[model samples]
Target: MNLLSDSRCGSEEEVRCLLVLPDINILSHSGVSHTVFWLLGIPGLEDQHMWISIPFFISYVIALLGNSLIIFVILTKQSLHGPMYLFLCMLAGADIVLSTSTVPQMLAVFWVHVAEISLDRCITQLFFNYSTFISESGILLVMAFDRYIAICYPLRYSSILTNSLIGKIGVAIFLRSYGTIIPIILLLKRLTFCKSNILTNATCKYIVLAPVSCDDIRINIWYGFFVLMSTVVLDIVLILHAVFRIPSQDVRHKALNTCGSHVYVIILFYGPGIFTTHTQRFEHHIAPHIHILLSNVCVPIPISEAIKTQALLS
Candidate 1:
């Protein structure tokens, strides 16, 4: 930890309590005593930390501003109270939480090298990060269903997706995403972090943090796998079903125009995730720093801009 103590006191020991750095502690599996865990920036590219942060910081700022704009427009404009726009507002909120949960820690690690995080704080970050991520997926799925209803049952769309129903969906996503995470978090309590405390990734994550545990985490791993596959696979199947049921070319065009930018954003959101999984699987062959960098900036960069583009075109 770097010292930022007050020199006017004239005693180094007295000012040692004012460490500006994070409490550098990462938890591991069962065995020894653990407390603060340290996080690392890109390993091989440590010298270029400032350079890496340029784009990461830019993306973080953009995601915040864009999503905030989305929420503002949707909330202020009563005309945008329909299901699709309402869901977009939910998604915008989720994305903002998602990006905020990760980017600050990453920038702290990159620019100031402040990577000290206690076990409690680490677990908190992990929960908020993963919960918001999964919630975003659920929101996207709901949006897909919104489009499906709009295109397939045009006459019944409003009746089916009433304001009350939208409220229920938002609540359900809140419950489901956090519900899935709470159990995993409780399960983590059973394990002792006996392994290395140094995390290779830029931020705290279940996948990265779980491996450092000395206990068997098969249940945690399997549950995570199930949630991920279930969400993505179900989305694909539902979207395909929606597309095949369109009545005519005009309906198809309407569908495309309605959610085409959304499709792009989904791809942008999940593409890095899929690739990050592969990179971790093939870590021996690939540079690990690349994976860390990818993880840090997983906030889809051009997503809000794409929505604006679609709006302008319309």
Candidate 2:
């Protein structure tokens, strides 16, 4: 009975959908959503559509090489086994996970034109993508706290930010991020996707999937906002507090220098997140390839900096 239902669900899904495969016209939900149109108005770069995929492919290559070097540097260097480098290693891991979750599938569609995505695969991609994204958020928050104690409370830094303490915090961040995902997944599970299974992008984003549902998704949207807000608010508070406690004029600059790279990272990370969260309409501005490339491929900056920091420490 279950197998029969599953098979029937696959075939009957699209006809039942109102939004994703709306009754308006045949071209309504067929090809990629017209995210490309908005890119045409970008000043002098309007004619660079073909070059968009070129940069995306180049970025994929950089992320692969840079993240691999991060892993290698952390593993091979003996003197780099401190709390800071440990967090760097974890950050590198998150970058690799994030890139792996997004890049190959994107390249497949760009190169081979394979656009169909099954429901199960869509959910799987969402799981990996969100998991890495949240984990990175949580880790960045903890990293901020780590820097806080190191610079502001230097006298007790060793005792306060001990090896065991770092381990416990790492585990807590992972749990907080990974555990928060359960409710979102459960929400998705309950949704009846009565639309085209063929996703427009290379992979599924929960927001993208929500429009296809015959069921009301207010709860899912609110919960997602709650999760995003908590991560952003908490991280910002920690970062601000860390900034406030700088010791002296000379060291203030040094302290800010230490966190500058991460500050850039948080801005880049959360900018798209805000875009994705509030305005689904803005998502149509960039080519899907450009969006994935900027968000996932730009991850190498953190990875490279983490490796360099670890090497200097060693």
Candidate 3:
């Protein structure tokens, strides 16, 4: 028997009444609850799990090694202790966390068919995934600010962005990312999933799971939109502004070269994100497999591109 369907609830009418009713006492007696989410993986590609697993595993390994090496080199080489490299270290760290947040579980789905995830674990994964994305956007904004200082005010760069200030900025980035997510998690905890417990993506993203809730999710949707707009969208605008304000042609060229790498990364990170978010929200005619594939692929692209960017900068 499917755990999602409880027989003690006399009929579909009674179950609907119990689920829809705001009475805690009725819900408690109904015993109809969803403790686990069935991850749908790639909806149309179930037979090719092994084939798909191969490339995903390879990407994860490359992302891990690449980001780890970037962090290691930055920490070990004293010559690279400038503000620019320090922020790069933070970016690499965020990439590692972001890639790890979902890839392992994705691999499990592809290899072992371990698709059922406990609700708590699902929430944890969603939180980490979003927090890392937010933190990376924050790091990119800080890096843009670092470049703006270096090019526009070279004499004051060191004095303005001291090691102490960079450390504080790092802390602030983490706090900003995590602060935005905590409320979402709290809101998620109060949600009741009385519909199908099957999640439509390989990973547990907020928007992916929000529709499954039987309760009103307009607040969740609006708040998530607010977070995305305030964080990544705002950062993109500032980064672009900083990129265009350099005074000297020679200095501007150099600044553009540095900012070019960041721009590439930003595009890679946000392009798919915007596409996925809009597609999920508006393009209901789109296939579930497309959403699953895009959501999974977008996370690692930044890490791989960051590795390339770091190499070019070095």
Candidate 4:
């Protein structure tokens, strides 16, 4: 029998689910419930799990310390109070959220072999994971615009991106990031898993979880495409235009020096996601465990805000 769990059910952490695929002649109680999932850490590499966790732990430390230091320095030092640093501060916070939501579960899975996750917690982590990821991208987009104004229109940059304006932009970007996640959550409420609760990825991601649903997920897929189209794609196009429009040789060098780290971080941030997305969409011949491990690669997601923070400060 195939089990299906609803993602709703407030105040309940356990998955009280029903059987799915009624057409397959499976019969069960008809009601709404949740599901529990376990992350199957690199199936064949079970013996090496401890060794694998060493690097994960190290990178987690680097991300935490690096971003925390950036946030601390920016907050304590009034000298570093500017639009660029402020945006870096925002990115740092998002990085902390993203990594925290993801790494602890992974560490648990690796260290103690505890991969069990309640559907509620999974969705909650899913919310933070994706919202932070998208918000980071949006923050970077705004950073690109901030750089554009700073380089292309130096004199007007201050007047245009005032503290008030920057705060508003930050709020707007955050709202936009979170608002986009609602559709996904609502969609999840309607889905029930027909597949085994054992998930391939350590983290509960929409991209990972959506495929296991027993319902028609076309709407979810299309809306996701819409979100990517309106936000990520548009941001990339505008950011590229903004970054490339340098007028003089000195100004060109100045822009590169100032914004190079931001661009590099963006590439590092998006590269693995792109590769994983394409691989998931295009290649099915690869082994499932291999695909799962590769998906976690994330181009090695030690997103060092330190570089960007140092560059902006320097």
Which candidate comes out best when scored by TM-score?
A: 3
Q: lDDT score, residue 309, model 3? A: 74
The worst-scoring run of ten residues by lDDT in candidate 1 lies at 3-12
Candidate 1 lDDT by residue in tens digits, 226-262? 7777665556566656765677978877776665545
lDDT of 4 at 116: 73
Write the residue-wise lDDT of candidate 2 on 211-232 in tens digits. 6666788899889889877776
Show model 2 residue runs off by greater than 4 Å: 1-51, 245-254, 281-314
Full-model lDDT, candidate 2: 0.61
Compute the lDDT for candidate 1. 0.71
lDDT-based ranking, best first?
3, 1, 4, 2
Model 2 error, position 241 (Å): 2.5
lDDT of 3 at 36: 76
Per-candidate TM-scores read 0.83, 0.74, 0.85, 0.82
Model 3, residue 287: distance off in Å is 1.2
Candidates, ranked, TM-score: 3, 1, 4, 2
